[model samples]
Target: MNHVISVINQKGGVGKTTSTINLGCAFANLGQKILIIDLDPQGNASTGVGIENNERENSIYKLLIERNNLQQYVKHTKIENLDIMCANVELSGFETEVAEDKNRAFILKGIMDELRQKNQYNQILIDCPPSLSLLTVMALVASNSVIVPLQTEFFALEGLTQLLKTINRIKMSLNKMLEVEGIVLTMFDKRNKLCAQVEQEARKFFGEQVYETLIPRNIRISEAPSHGLPVIVYDKYCAGSIAYEKLAAEIIEKQKKFNFAA
Candidate 1:
């Protein structure tokens, strides 16, 4: 079965892109076919996986507003099992280009459904931008579920409330099946008392919605992207890589439970 998961966090610097790249690689390391969609205009996810800016002529922008062919856009990354559909600054103007379309949100969903039916990928991970605009709405409509990364910073919980409201509103109006897969805490500094407090409060409120895995603040995780590799591949023994591997395993286990129930 294929699953499309949007790695979203409207708030920036929450480790959304980092999680998307490494988690996808983690699954790939398990021998699963994965496609990573870089939906952000920043193109960090694309570059993180070694897709250069000059090589994005046939990126997601073309796939969305121009050519709707996956083969024309999908590009291979350094990882054997992971492929990517990139994005660039042109994506920022997409909203204005489709302003007259009544069903703009469904554009991405339609394209994703085609890829889903082909069953080429076991997992499709979308790295969304840091805003709840039409792009994020489109991602939510296209995804089976979303995985949010919450940074252990002050006022993190306050921002989560607003994001949840947006998710609920999207569910009410767009995709009713849109579900939250889980939330992971990022940049957790155990030496900091405030980080511990944030984790405790988050667990108290979110409970089972929060994953048991915690991505600690690690220099290797940040350095891997500069070298255009996932942390798991850049340095497999790093804390970030270990946590993401655990996250992928947990996600697979959850899928088993979901399949059994179905």
Candidate 2:
């Protein structure tokens, strides 16, 4: 079965796009067919996977507005089993454009339901914008679960509370099956006492809902997006790359348990 998950965080600069792109690549490397939906107007996920701005003419914006023919919008990334539906600044206007439609929130969900019928991908990851806007609502309504990239910093948990509330609101009214897959602590610095403190607090509060993998504050991860590549592919041996690969394995194992339970 295909799993559709949104890599989401309301606060910006939390490694949300970085986690989405790297995790998609890691899943692909593990022989899973992955489709990354660049729902963020900034299009960082598209650029991270090597989809240039010029190539985003048929982007997620068009897909949401046109509302048909999903395959025509999907573009293959440099990775073998990874694909992406690019997005650009034009997507920022989507909220205003769809204001009159009461069913606007289900637009992406309809597209996702169609994709599931095709069964072309093992995993679909949506890179949500850094805000609790209409786009984020659409993604939350479409996804089966969410993977939150919680930055290890002051007020991290405070920001997470708002996001969790939003998810709960969506689950109650929009998507009944919506759940948090796991919380990934990003940009962790082991030597920093605050980072360790944040991790302990997160594990204590969320317990098993937080993953074991901690993505370190590595320069390699920050540099990979400029090179239009995932850190795992740019430098396979880097600390960031190893962490993402391990996270992917952990996610897969969790999925197996979920499937068995189902």
Candidate 3:
């Protein structure tokens, strides 16, 4: 399926941007053409994947605000099969600027509709901002499914309960087809007892809704963004990179199973 998956978490520091970058690249390495839309105002995903501030001439801001040709906004990354729609601080003003537009929520959906028809990429990953604002709403409205990164730290599950409620509300009203593909536990530290406890509770409650692959807290993952690259590209042998690779493989296999059943 030519699916659009938004990597989202309302709570910050849950590895949302990190997952979007590394996981998208992992899928690309698996030979799937991928497009990453940096929907975050912070634009961490854009910076993490090597799109410098100077390179972002036609960003998501222009794509949404200017409503020009979407093709011109899509920038091919150094990665072989991955492209990006960059973003920066200018995107923070989009909400106030489009305040009077009655159909603003549907703007992203309309743009994605054209892309879906093209079927140029196997998957499109949207890096949503930390809050459930207009941009996050737009991503949710446009996405077929979401991949939530649940941090294994204290109060992580508490935040997820609220996020799930938000997802349900959006599903019932905005996009009836939207679904949570699965929850991937991130920042897992085996040394921390709390991390393991959190994982156990999540698996017990969510069952198959949580992915088997867990992303450990790694220095390389943090360091990659400084170099404007994904952890997978910076150090393929690192634990964080390996986990994303496994996650990508699992996602492909799971989709194949569902397709066969259908």
Candidate 4:
């Protein structure tokens, strides 16, 4: 069964794109056929996976507006098991376009359902925009699980509360199977007292929802998008790459338990 997961955060700087791209790559490295869907207009996940947004012909925008088939939008990545549904600036209008559609919230879910029935991927990782807009609602409706990438900062926690509330609302109203897969702490700097304090407080509140692996603030991760490559491919030995691999394992282990229960 394909496990569809979304990396979501209402806060912009929380590393949602970074986590989605790297964790998708890491899962591919473990021999899973992974599809990374760039649901953000910024399309950082597209660039992170080496898909040039400037060259996109059919993007997630088309998928949302035209109900484009998932196969038509999939672009191959340099990584073996990783493919991407690229997004571009055109996606900025997607929310407005779908705003009035009665089934707008399930647009993405409908596309993904068709793809899942086709059985083309082992995992689907969606990179949600940093908001509770229609796009995020669509992604949440499409996904079975959500991994919230949070920054170990004061405001990040507050944003997380709002995101969790939105997820709860979605679960109650749309996708009943939706669940919090895990929380990943990102942009962490061990040398900073603020980072430590924030992480401790997050653990106190989120507890088991937080992943064991913490992504440190690493320049390599920030630089990789400029080169249109995931941090793992840009610098395999980097701290950010290592953290994502650990996170991938954590996710896979949880999925394994779920599969056994099923």
Predictions in order: lDDT: 0.90, 0.94, 0.90, 0.87
What RMSD does each model have against the real structure?
A: 1.4, 1.2, 1.6, 1.5
The local distance difference test score of model 2 is 0.94
lDDT of 1 by residue, 69-154 (tens): 67889998989999999999999999999999998999999988999888899999999999999899899998888899999888
Rate residue 151 of model 1 by lDDT: 98
Regions of model 2 farther than 4 Å from truth: 260-262
TM-scores for all predictions: 0.97, 0.98, 0.97, 0.96
> Ten consecutive residues with minimal summed lDDT in candidate 4?
253-262
The most accurate candidate by lDDT is 2
The model with the greatest TM-score is 2
RMSD of 4: 1.5
**Model 2: number of clashes?**
0
User: Model 2 — TM-score against the truth?
Assistant: 0.98
79-161: candidate 3 lDDT, tens digit per residue: 99999999999999999999999998888999899888888888999999999899999999998889999999878888888
User: For candidate 1, what is the lDDT?
Assistant: 0.90
